[model samples]
Target chain A: MKKDEVPQDDANVLEGKLKTLKYATNEDGSYVQVQTVGWEPENLALSQAWEDIHERLEIIAQDIAAGKSSPILYFMEKCLMEPPMLAKHMGIGTWRVKRHFKAKGFAKLSQKRLEKYAYVFEVPVEHLTQFDPTRTS
Target chain B: MTNKFNHRQSAHCENGVVSNLLYHEGIDLSEPMIFGIGSGLFFSYIPFVKLNGNPGTSFRIYPGYIYKRATNRLGIKTKMRTFRNAEKAMDALDANLEKGIPTGVQTSVYYLPYLPSQYRFHFNAHNIVIYGKDGEEYLVSDPVMDDVTRIKRSDLMRARYAKGVLAPSGKMYYPINVAKDFDLKPAIIRGIQHTAKDMLTIPVPMFGIKGIYKLAKDVRKWPEKVGERKAGLHLGNLVRMQEEIGTGGGGFRFIYAAFLKEAAVIMDMPELNEIADGFTKVGDRWREFAIMASKIFKQRTNVQGDYQLAADIIVDCADQEKVLFTKLRNLKFPA
Candidate 1:
């Protein structure tokens, strides 16, 4: 791509706060580094991916509200994590992590266990326990 | 006990880290040179591996291979360590800084507070250099950033220990010995040859130029094999990996082209210059593919025929790369 041809498409996800570096061909056919705000195709791909994540999270949030699931699922989806991944982060068995996804199993958790989960999620234990579904996306 | 580290930005992280560290040691090598000599250019599409519920795609070699291979070919000795205990890892890093060593640390992008919120994800294997320390903060030289930045000790710790796939686990490395004088000709040849062989001769359909063809075939089947939304998500993931951050566009193809240009001058091979231009065209095709795939991903077009069109573009890319790498593999080098 030519230096002048580097895409400067407005990526609202970047919020106009940052510019990324790119390599473009100069007149001599040699490469020079150029800063780009964003490219249209890349921005579209990114938004679509994020949209998929949000859609999944919205479904999980509804489940939590209906008492079919726990807040753990909500936070897990928010963080782009699966049960196996969350289990690895929490240093627990995979089956145990799955159990925690349910409301009944989550209610029986001890304080120490809750603290461990909170630490991995980087949230306070109280926030996990008293999460408001409407406040989150 | 801080080392006199000079920070310079580059198009990619590992390449930037390798080039900056070598420059700090009084051996100046541009990021393109480091990337080329390191055999960093690669491609792989693993359908079995899932990321974000989509098949994984990689545009470069495995993490840390660039540093390992590039330095090895240059005959530089380096020390690397990874720790299971976070406290011990932090202590080891502090000790290295105490000895005036600017250490390369692998971290998770998600925990780096200096980055924009949108860029923060569960991505591990991001590399940065720590040159000095203040009371509770450490000076960071992230190759992707335009300027040097700082991170709190606590934040750095979290980044190092962030869990999930390819977790850093507090990995740190630094060059211990670099030869005062060395020749670049042989290393450049070895790097080029290594890349050609890998791209052309890899037997697996999921790797090398073959991987591109496989992905092209898969792209056509995606909407049929899976539903539209899932297939679109898969294509979106492919675009994310292709135009990955810090690659300077067209995956890593542009950097490889720059490397070839530099190598042509140093090795006095005019033929290599022509080859470099060909590869640049291939890179352009890759970008073209991204553009089409992104449209399909966003469902911007009403026609379902877009899938076959996108697949054709990918096939064109694969065919171009096949010709380039075959010519590259057959090229002769001066002893």
Candidate 2:
């Protein structure tokens, strides 16, 4: 907070349209009120990580479209889980989970199996099974 | 009935909301003051509770504790309610807004349109104030934002009903009444004492000072037990918990230090200033741990991170906090 000690009336004005914190300052470059404690470093890093997560999601969506990977991968990433974690949650083996990650294997999933995944992901069964990967929302 | 409420940006959500509401009530209090009086600080590491496949590690008390405790200390009688149905919750908020009462509501952070997409997650327990409505959009005063932002009813509803751990459940709260006086000395004393006991006296090893030590020990084993990639994820998550999200860094140690500094001035307890400085150093140590972990996360190092060394750093933090809280617990405040 030594930054706060710079005798000022306001924090510097933020530049970007993004809602991240910025300092407000006077025209003469005097100190003013702080918009927030700057999170530039941490948030910058988080943004990169989030981009990576979304990148995986986009690839999974492509796989689903190409009938390669199943929509299960999409739900898994949405729920912030990996195969091993979901396998543990579903009381199944990781190999089974990995198999289910394929479109052909997922299409043959039992109602009971699909229901278990829906339960763990906290999504409706229909939403899980009939989801449109292209739908951004 | 909508009043033009002053919107001030703050470091954290709940504390900002509390400060804004109090200011509207004609009581100007700093965010740290509200936090300290409300006893907003706490620690709990529940390995059984999982968030994104990692053990749930929280630096502060559950959401709404600060608003509840801080308001009560100020003799403010507030009404808070949660609903099973989203319609009723929206109806109640509309009613309060119609009555010119800016109400506080909890929502998930993911759906707030004003925030950067990267920062948005499924995490619930974000607090904001609804000050007005224009046709379909509600005027929102999200504390972390630089100005008042507008959100459509549908988006806001989705935010309120967001599912997952610690779901908001369409919860809203507002102060129904405010008293003329609140005796601060006792509240400050009580809050400090409560924090001390929780940090030092709690028998559970996964909470307070013990929790810090336990995390230090458990974290070292993550690489062995979960593999390098997943272990790396856990460490990164720990950093997020400490630095990103709602924490103002070092799990809010610096914020608490600022609180102590203000408390010292208000109560004429200059010694509290010394303790506050110590806490700042503690926060710095936390930052140090974070910097070290960041290197591991970025895979910048040639060899695997020295988990033992990192664990030692946290143990040192815990040790410093233990001694500091002990002194704070034993300190006699003037009656």
All candidates' TM-scores?
A: 0.97, 0.82
Worst 10 residues of 1 chain B by lDDT: B295-304
lDDT string, candidate 2, B10-108, tens digits: 767999999998888887887777778888878888888777667889888888789987887778899999998889889988988888898889998
Query: DockQ for all models, in order?
Result: 0.69, 0.17
Question: In model 1, what lDDT does residue B283 have?
Answer: 87
Residue B198 lDDT in candidate 1: 95
Residues forming the 10-long window of minimal summed lDDT in candidate 1 chain A: A11-20
lDDT of 1 by residue, A1-137 (tens): 88899988876665554567788898888988888878888888888878888888789878888888998888888877888879998889989998989999999998998998888888888777997766643
Best by TM-score: 1
Q: After superposition, how far is residue B5 of candidate 2 from its true place, in Å?
A: 0.6
TM-score of the first chain of model 1: 0.90
Regions of candidate 2 where Cα sits further than 4 Å from its true position: A4-69, A72-76, A79-137, B300-305
Clashes (backbone N, CA, C under 3 Å), per candidate, total: 0, 16
Per-candidate chain B TM? 0.98, 0.97
